[model samples]
Structure formats: structure tokens, C-alpha cells
Target: MALTGAASAPPRLAPGGVVTRADALLAALRAAAPDPARLPRDAGALLGERAALAGLRRNGRIAAGGRARLLCAADGWIAVQLARPDDVALLPAWLEVDPARFEGDPWPALAAAVRDRAAVPLVARARWMGLPAAAAGGGSAEGGAPGMDAKPPLAEARRAGDAPPSAAEARPADGAPPRVEAPPALRVTQAGTPRRRHAGPWRVLDLSSLWAGPLATHLLAGLGARVAKVESTARPDGARRGPAAFFDLLQAGKESVALDFRAPAGREQLRRLVAWADLVVESARPRALAQLGLDAEALLAEHPGLSWLSITGYGRPEPGGGWVAFGDDAAVAGGLVARDDDGAPLFCGDAIADPLAGLHAAWAALGALRAGGGRLLDVSLAGVAAEAAAGGVDPRACVVADAGGARVLCAGRSARVAEPRARRPAGRARDLGADTTALLREARA
Candidate 1:
């Protein structure tokens, strides 16, 4: 289903039509699954899982989750996500304010600081400092125009040693002279015969935290994959501090193995766990894992039948690989925000990018596995949001005002703009490290 048009005020779900898109992808996934019943029936509903638990709502300049805000800059609006304490701590530095004077909440000071600054420089500075920030409507540090068409690809994949085509080497689809260089959206890093050998459920080693990665693996688990989630003993998933039901919904069926990455024995156990899986899912920056001596390329090379799914904010490409992002800001970077009556940007859903990326990542991982593993699937939150926005609003879709607020009418079917709902957890999620000892003992055996 498409979002309502511009002639009237679009409902809160207008901008990305992400729920509709996710529903389509989910349907395709179920069609390809060995057991269609294993997958969830409503992809659109999954997008609102977190909101359902957190009780979030759509606020024009403020994100539904209330952690990110769209503040005005001298040139345009920019989204700054203070989702973490570290992000809040960096505010004084980001705004060039005196730490001694900065007190209480940072939003007022932040809003005042950026009121006279240009968005491009502010965004560039925030990214350099590792803050999750982005210009409204897809503007970047490179000065790209703010529009849906100018947004970067939802995700780009590349093999080792691959580079963007030179202008001279590129060609337009219309058979005209090459105007600009562009990198391929996806490329097979390695080819292998399709591994139709499904003697048992696929084993998945999940080394991701929070929403995107965990949600992907959770979906895989729902499809009968045996998933083992690995978390650091010192730093368990931050989600544990949030709503219990939300955390349980994403982690219900997985075995938890907490390891101390700083210790040699722990790292060894991690390597063994990696060896034990047919697929590995992670969301760390490209270099973060390499620093831990767990490189994707090296692991893929060693395990020719392994499939690795890497979820990131931007992607693994050079400059973007170094940037930090969260769901709200990343959605802004992807041009996925709804437009207000004055054409200003508004946060559409509750950290919408996370679920969108999660769904896409799960789908991509399954495809790679079906193709016989030996591949790295790089899925980015911003990239997926951009792709969703690229589909544009469906002209046939319209919003009908009703006594209960608003309902979206599309293709002769109407759905109410209701509160997001959570799914029943398949089972209780195991405590952190609950399976570490047993799994490690089995690995040794």
C-alpha cells in the first residue's frame, strides 16, 4: 500500500510507506521458505514492535521514541540522536559550549547552538565525532542536494579490491556518454554450488546487539534456525536495560553465550563458536571485529560454506564505514521522514530504520544461505531506508478521517492508524551466558 498524497495532510505513516514495503518483502520470504507458516503473517506490524512496548507516538520535530530531534540549522534542519549517554556527553564539544556552564538537559542548548550554523558542517562535525547525526532530506558533508533522488543506495556490496568505476569507464543506461561514477549495489564475493543439503536446521551464530541484528536472527530462528547469540560479558546488550518484553520479543528463542573478548580464552571460544555455525550475523563496524581478530574475510575464507550477514548504519565502504548512526538519524540520512504541512521533515515511526534493516537483513541472509553460503551480505540501515523512500508515495493510497482518528485506504483495503502491537514471544530468552559453559564444553569435545 502507498502513502496518501500531498493535496491533503498525510497521516503519520505517509513518508516511507515502509510497512507496505516490508510486507511485500516478508511475503516473498515466506513464499521461498520451506515452511511458510514459520514466518510472521504481517511484516508491516513488525515495524512497530518497539513502539508498542515503549508507548511512543509521532511528534513532528521530535522523534516518536523521543531520543532524536530535528533541530533547525542556519541552512536547513538536521537530526541529532542523543540515544546514548556518550552522545549526551559529547554535546558540549559538538556545540562548542563550555562544559562548566552546560547544565541540565542538553536540548535547549543544542537547539540554540545550531540555530545559526549551516547543516553540512554541523553534520560533518557530528559524524567525525562519532555522534549519530544527519541532515534532513539526505544532505551530506559532500554537499549533495537534499532530496529523495540524491540519497545514497540503501546498501552497497563489494568484493575485495573492488573500486568505484571511473567516470570514463561508466556508461548511462540511455547509451549516452558517462557522466558520473557509481559503485555496484551488490556483487558476489565468492561463488559456490547451491548447498541444497538441508539435512538439519541451519546453525546461526549471532554476534549482534540491540535491534537490527537481533531482529534478523530472531526471524531466522522463527524459521527453524538454531541460533546462538554471543554477547560480551562486560557489555551485555544495552537492550537489557530497556523494556523486558521488547528485548524478549527479539531474543526469545536464541541461546545466549556471553564471552569476554578481552581474554584469550574468551576469544578462542568465540572462534570456536564461529566455526560451529553455518551462518554468522554481526553489526559491528568493519574494523571493530578485525581488531578483535575476527575478520569476516578471513572467516569466510576459512569456512568455504559459511554465510556472514553484516548489519551497519551506513555500510562497509570507506568513508561511510567510519561514520556512526542510529535508527532515527539514519532514517533521516535515507530521506525517509514524513513531510509536515509546510514541507518540513517529521520522524515517521519509532526508530523505523531498525526494523526495516532487520527485515531486509534477514531476507538477504536467507538468500545467501540458499545460494550455498560463502558470501558476505552487507546490510545498512540508512541504505534500506533510502531504498524504501525511493519507492515514493503510492498515488492510489489515501487517508480517510474516521472517529477513531485516521485509517489508510489502499487497494480497496483499509487499515487503521492504530498503536503498534507486539507479538507473543515464542519462549523466554535465556539469561546472558546461560549457555556459555555448555556450548564451550561441546566445542572442546
Candidate 2:
């Protein structure tokens, strides 16, 4: 598929070239979809929807959503995100400072503490403590070189652990010394089987929260999939706590099944739900699912027709698998930041990586389904961001300012920054666990 839109079309919908890449993916998705009309006409608009709903703006140093910041360390720059209270509580430990030193707002203290520290070590400490942080321009596309703009694969599909690693998977894309620690951008883990076309709408079990995974299934739902979203009663989708309208936009049209995985009955209900699904979309870390006895590899082995989409901050491999990351920091990890006139990196948009990954994940899932279903698709926020960055317009040339305000320029054209627009919620999103009783009863039957 083509990686970009036509030159006559607006190559960018926002400051960076992400919208351009998103447009390309959306075109491919529309072409491949059974119902092309179900997808949005301009996927670029989806990139800014979160920001528009939240009234977020592009701050050169602050993330569009205002939850993350780009700060200068002694050696280089780094991005840090404290989107949750739990993340804030760990700041003292991450910075090795006394908790008493921080009070009302933490940014001032954080900036002071990080200013004299080296970026790499601080990022390392933050990741070790589960805080989302990354050094600016540190990512390597396909394990090329740190900060190189080469394109990386959107998803890495590999055969489960039962199969041996292929030679291509064992080496870096650049033919450098072997670094098996890094996963390849994309690989065909399992050979494609004859297409196993579904007789009816595909049944999708979505066990993911937040933007990327839900957006993937939401797109699928738009394309006539029967989607059931499984949540935990104890800890439901955190999005439920945010703007209800925003939550509704992503969760609309999907039946809700809330289960407490801690309970034996709930676990069994989850397994039964999995059995009922033709495809599964989840964003949990590998270990989190393994603890629940719903390991993807084993499940794929057990169900020959199953297709699994695993979305994470990084690919499911050592080093990356264990690390913690969020959208802003993951984008930074992928070197997907826009550059200011002085060459300093700035966040391109609101959780840019999440939407990009969401688009790629949905497209990959559909491709897997078309190829007859026994596939494990591994998509990472950082990897997708890198791919967009590699294929994106030059950061320096993307934004220009006039008295009218900042405008994005691409492919010899200029356009005003587009506001995020939401499609009317497909339908009102069902309340959390609203379908639990009926779903569980059906499973029992």
C-alpha cells in the first residue's frame, strides 16, 4: 500500500506529518474493508479529536493534552508524563527527592530537579520506577541508529514461542552486530492460510482500555463487527472517569461485559467469552494476561481460527516488554517529535502515537482476518510513532507562523490547524457491566 497521500491533497492535517501517514493508512483500510463507507473520510481528524474534546493546545514544551512536558536535562532533552496520581506519587522516588519538597503543583519542582541531571540516567530511573519518561531523539527506526528518521514497521507479527526465531528476526535491519533483544518491525510469523471468510459479522472480544485498542475495535465495529468489550468490575476502563462524551465516542456500539478477573467465576466467564470470539483485541502486558491463564500463544494454539492483536507501549520482548511507556513518552522514544526553529523537539499532538497505533492495529487486524486467522499481531506505540515519523514531513518545515496563528505546511501547501471533530457516538455507549448478566448467562447456556 502507498505510504502517503497524493501531493495535491493536504499532506498534513496537523503540525507534523502524522496526519499524512494516518490518511494513507485510512485509505488502505477503506480499500480492504468490506464496507469502506464505515471508515471516516479523513482519518486525520481522529488524531486531534482527543485534544479538541479536552480543549488541549499545542504547547511547545507541554504536551497538547497538558499531561506531559519536555524538559532539558544536563546532557539532553527528555519527555516526562504524570497523567495519573499514582504516577505523581512516584515522582519523589524517581527524582530521588524528599516527598515533602513537593506540594500543590509539581512542575516547578520537577523542572528544577531534572535540570541538572543527565537525560539518559533520569529516563532510566523513571522507567525502572514505572514512570513514563524518555530522552528526546533517542529512538532508532528498526533498530537503525538512535534518532535516525528511518521508517519502522507498524506491527511485528511473529509465530508464537513454539516456533524457532527466523534469521531475519535475529538480526537488526542495518546488519549491525546482532541485537536479538530488539524485535523486528514486521515479520510473518505464520504463513497465510486460505481465506476463511466469515459467514456473518466477525465476533470481537475487546479487553482493552484507553485510546489505541478501543479505537481499533471501534473501527471494526463500524465495519459491521459484533464487538463485546470486557472490563474489570474492580478496575474498569479508566476512560470512564474522563469526559463521558469522549468515552462514549470510543465505546459506542460495543456491548459491555464487566468481570472481576480475581474471582474464579469471573475468570471462567472471561475464558468463555474468549471462546466465543473470532478475534481478540487487548492492550495488557504479556505477563498480566498470562497470570489470568489467557496467554495469547496458548489460546491461539487451542483455537486454530483465532486472531489476536496485542498492543503495548513496546513490543513483547525483553527490555521493551518490561519497560513502562505512555503515548507522549513513547513518541519521544520513537523520535517522533516536531522540532522548534532552534532544533529542540516538541510534542506533535495529543498522544499522537496512540491514534497512529490505533489506525495501524485496526488495519493489521483486518489483514490478519483476511489471511485466515491464526495470527499474533504485536503492535507497539513507539514502533508506530517511529513509522509515522520516518514517513512524515520534515519537522522543521511542517509549521509556519503568521499573524493568523500557527499553520501547518506540507507538500507545497499550507492549511490552518484542524480542530478535532467527533463523529456522533455510533450509539450511546452501554454502561459498564450492563451486559454482564446476559452475557454470562449466554455463556453458561
For all predicted structures, in order, the TM-scores are: 0.85, 0.83
Estimate, for each residue in 1-445, the C-alpha lDDT of model 1 and write its tens digit.
Answer: 1122222344544454577779887888787777887678887678887877877656666877788898977666789998888998987776667865457888888888777776655676676667888877532221222454322322233322344332222112332111111212233456333444345788899998889999999889867788999999998998999888989888988889999999998898899988778899998888788867888877887776788888888777765676788888887777777765456667767777788888888888888877779888888788787777654555666667778867878899988766577787766789999999998886676
RMSDs, each prediction? 7.3, 7.9
Clash pairs (backbone) in predicted model 2: 159-189
lDDT of each: 0.72, 0.70
Residue-level error in angstroms, candidate 1, position 209? 1.0
For residue 69, model 1's alpha carbon misses the true position, in angstroms, by 0.7
In candidate 2, stretches whose alpha carbon ends up further than 4 angstroms from where it belongs are 1-16, 138-188, 191-198, 395-412
User: What overall lDDT, based on C-alpha atoms, would model 1 receive against the true structure?
Assistant: 0.72
Deviation of model 2 at 218, angstroms = 0.6
- lDDT tens digits by residue: candidate 2, 1-445: 0111122222222223566779988888888777887777788678777766766655666776678888876656788998889889988777767897777899989888877666655665566567787767542212112444222221133222222232123222332211111233333345223335357788889998889999999888877788999999899998888777778888888999999899998898899988777788998878788877788877777777778888888777644665667788787777676554355566767788788888988888887877778888888888777666654344344544466644766578876754556666656799989998988776566
Any idea what lDDT model 2 has?
Answer: 0.70
Q: Quote the RMSD, in angstroms, for model 1.
A: 7.3
